[model samples]
Target: MPAAATVNSPRHAMSDTLNQPTSFSAIDFLRTKSLANVVQAEIERMIIDGEFQPNERVNENALSQRLGVSRGPIREACSALAAMGLIEIIPNRGFFIRALSSDESQDLSEARAGIFGCMAMMLAERVTVAQIAILRALLARMDEIVALGEVHTYYPVNLEFHKQIASMAGNNRLGSIYQSFVRELHIQRYRALSSPDVLHISNAEHREIVDAVEARDPVRALIAGRAHILNGIVRAKKAQQAGEATAQAKAAPRRTRRTAAAMEETAAGTPADAATKPRARRGGLSKTD
Candidate 1:
């Protein structure tokens, strides 16, 4: 098997967290090997599945009850998650799912692009025939999914395809970083690939990556890999803008029936004694009122 971090293995993720200083103590490290690790994985799964949405506070008491554990384990697991860039720990507050701003998301995508590009170059020069076959199979699977235009199904396969390449690159360090970035990008990636067209376009780039690797063209492989992620950043930005526009439209309330009628009355010139007319009682105005 490749030296990649398995789909949800905590060992590799813990190792990365242990190396980083997020106030994750030695005691917490040992806890991860024990009960806390299970809790961590469950919470990670929740985030991945969008059960626990971004910026939503994790109710520790609720988790403790749900997992049949005390708050201690829940807290420890959340601390570990914070280290993994999946949660944010606010002083005096609590843990929340990490929500990346557009700028921060762009920074992370650029970073991943650099590392993924480098790994693609490595794969081009040394990938074995078996690895190539695995990639081809994933590509075929993705093509099938795209034909049906099922992005929800295609997204995970797309992730697996890139992860397979990261593992086949033969560098554990790069693979670990790539995995962490992948974890961080999960929420935004769904937005970046909001439609079947995006999924189809993304896989086309994957074809370039595979072809370059097969031809042992390191330069072409690197370009293809970097371009894939950089283009994804553009998609992410577009997604962000679209979301913002939607939010703005929501925030600017629609003109109520009463307001519209008042505007019309003013436009047509109100009667001279309109002020003397008994004003209607103040009440909430419905859209159709």
Candidate 2:
């Protein structure tokens, strides 16, 4: 018989993808949970905060010693993060955080506009009074955080606002996908909105989006979300440029140390594959470049 016809349905495709197993088992899922998860979470936080600059080696030995764990779990956690696309793996080298690019940022904003707009439209049709009340309370908290200028905590609160809106949109899949981008996207937004003049404008747009959602006006909500995302893209590019400039200045001294390490390693004539390898991504978040 000819090869069986593939199920082309969206539901079937999503089910197949989500059901795929990771490299580890549940009981042993977190062998030495405290150390591995702690290291993973801390590294993730650094990526979100832009501390461990993108596209740079994540030293397994260094992190292993720092977190007081064997290289095995550290390697496992790095593998998990690579699976999440928060980091990238290069042949003959270790993992590095994914970098930002102008085109990629534009594409992401467009994707957010499309997905979030669909969500808002669905939510408007099904939203209850109680849901609106809950959202209003959350927005109030965001406003308070913004007013206090507690920059760090503002991101989590901001993510909560988006998550609530996504949940209200009545699509679990959309919400799950949106949640994945929470770390990177929020960091981008925070960087862009750091300026005093731009900060209030972003807050105003957020309020507008909430108002639209409350009014059950999908079109307005869609427009508001799109405008917000595009503005964020512009601001992020500016911020990333400034940040990269600062980082380059700091990299001058570190460059010499890195060069020496690379030369020493080369002189040893060790095979590159001895290092941790990055898993090949079949496809999902289309690899751009």
Candidate 3:
């Protein structure tokens, strides 16, 4: 065949290869990411809200049904969460909710403190009067909750107050990072704020942040924001210690009871084997008379 004829051939080998459809493309990748993002958000909410407890296996089938999506999206979501330290994937056993270690929790808290401080600083410079009013209203509502000693009720509202701060800060990247930390610290945050005193203290810190922001004092606001979370670390530690003491106290009684039972057994002076064996007569024989 002439060179011109070969160049224009319809059945060219290169053309056939080029025309073959790819198994996956950019469109497919984007669609998968979109679906997985939805799944990831829902499952993240479940874990952070304690709907799915720590160390519990993630039920992909249940999630797929609930979200009305396939297991592929659910698995993809779980893998993403695992990367965020919200879940763990083990070979053969599947994904489970991750429980942060003490050090891990502290590291997350400190990083969150930094993010929150930055948000407060940014808000102080650019915050509107309406935002201040919103925060003040949240604080007022929190005061009522504190007075009523409603830890459970106060916790969600506290979350909202901080969320509003993040949103108002107007930095999407910072807000996203702050929210991730919040999710990771949910368990510890709840435990810390479970106390009435802690609730009062937390609300007071909220006031400090609002006060500084209202006055347009970024330094004060930064300090207040960092202090709020760092103080929470203190409260969290105390709460954990107190909980441990209570557990030890409760376990102490059981341990004492076990000890007493063991002592009583020893006092009875009857061995199980001794009961089964024949008693020797005259110190030497069975004495079959």
Candidate 4:
């Protein structure tokens, strides 16, 4: 039988390939990032874009279908997001977008202020002329945006300005932590800086910070950075209060109308005009008397 036709045929050349060393490529590195990371990033974008409102439930099935992925990856992604403080998971209710309470938001702002202050101080000590030039260029761009009254476009440039400062600080860990804080405060910061006046004020603060850094005055840089973030917190609070007040003003008339309707229902069988008129006293003297 031709020696039973040796099993190691030319077509079955697995031994040679198996013995060879494996090599990695860009694709392998990309694959190492995991599907969950990709899903997490996309979900983060959705939250940042306000597609998912605070406290809104995350529909795993819907996201799975939308992203063309399996439910396992969606769950994994949600778990990662939860770890990042961007989502909350309930035992039986599933995951909901995390909403920071006012106190919590304030606390985060304070913490970020400290971190940013330190970053600014470090950058002031270590920043080079090239870095300062880059920052000035960004400021120029911001100035142009402000001149055009395009407040919306200023937000991204504002973020880039701060990020460049953090980068120039030469501390990767600090940059990573600062980035997390920025992500957490993304929506709130946008709301805070939405006003053109607030944007101008913030840009002025940025200029002060840049000036301090350029002068290599770490103490001044620290104070400027801290003040800028603290001012942002105040501005955000004021904006929130103003929004609430406006909403209440808009709703007051509707609520009053509702109450009036309920009163009318209670006084059924009375004339419509009588609802607004005070009832006459019983057994009182007539006007003729």
What candidate 2 gets wrong by more than 4 Å, as runs, is 1-38, 181-187, 244-289
- TM-scores for all predictions: 0.73, 0.67, 0.73, 0.76
Q: What is the lDDT of residue 253 in candidate 4?
A: 100
lDDT (0-100) at residue 14 of candidate 2? 80
lDDT computed for candidate 1: 0.87
For model 1, how does the per-residue alpha-carbon lDDT over 1-289 read when each residue is reduced to its tens digit?
A: 3555373478878777778765567667666678888888888877876688789999998898899999998999999989989899988899999999878888899999999999999999998899999999999999999899987788788889988999999999999999999989887877788767777898899999999999999999999999999998888778778888998877666646568877888887677446545343223233337
Q: What global local distance difference test value does model 3 have? A: 0.88
> Residue pairs in steric clash, candidate 2?
none
How accurate locally, in lDDT, is each candidate? Answer: 0.87, 0.73, 0.88, 0.87
Q: What is the C-alpha RMSD of each candidate to the true structure, in Å?
A: 12.6, 20.7, 12.2, 9.8
Predictions ranked by TM-score, top down? 4, 1, 3, 2
Worst 10 residues of 1 by lDDT: 279-288
Query: For candidate 2, what is the lDDT?
Result: 0.73
Give a tens-digit lDDT track for model 3, residues 212-259: 999999999999999999999989889989988999999999999999
Please, what are the lDDT tens digits per residue for candidate 4 over residues 58-99? 998899999999999899989988888889999999999988
**Candidate 3 residue spans exceeding 4 A from truth:** 1-46, 49-53, 56-80, 269-289
Q: Over the stretch 1-289, how does candidate 2's per-residue lDDT look in tens digits?
A: 2223346667778878766676335435567565667678877877776577667789888887777788987777787788777778887887887775767656777678677767776777678899888878877876777777765666666667778889888788988787666544645766876554565566677788878878888888888877777777787788778888999989987999999888888887545734422323423224743
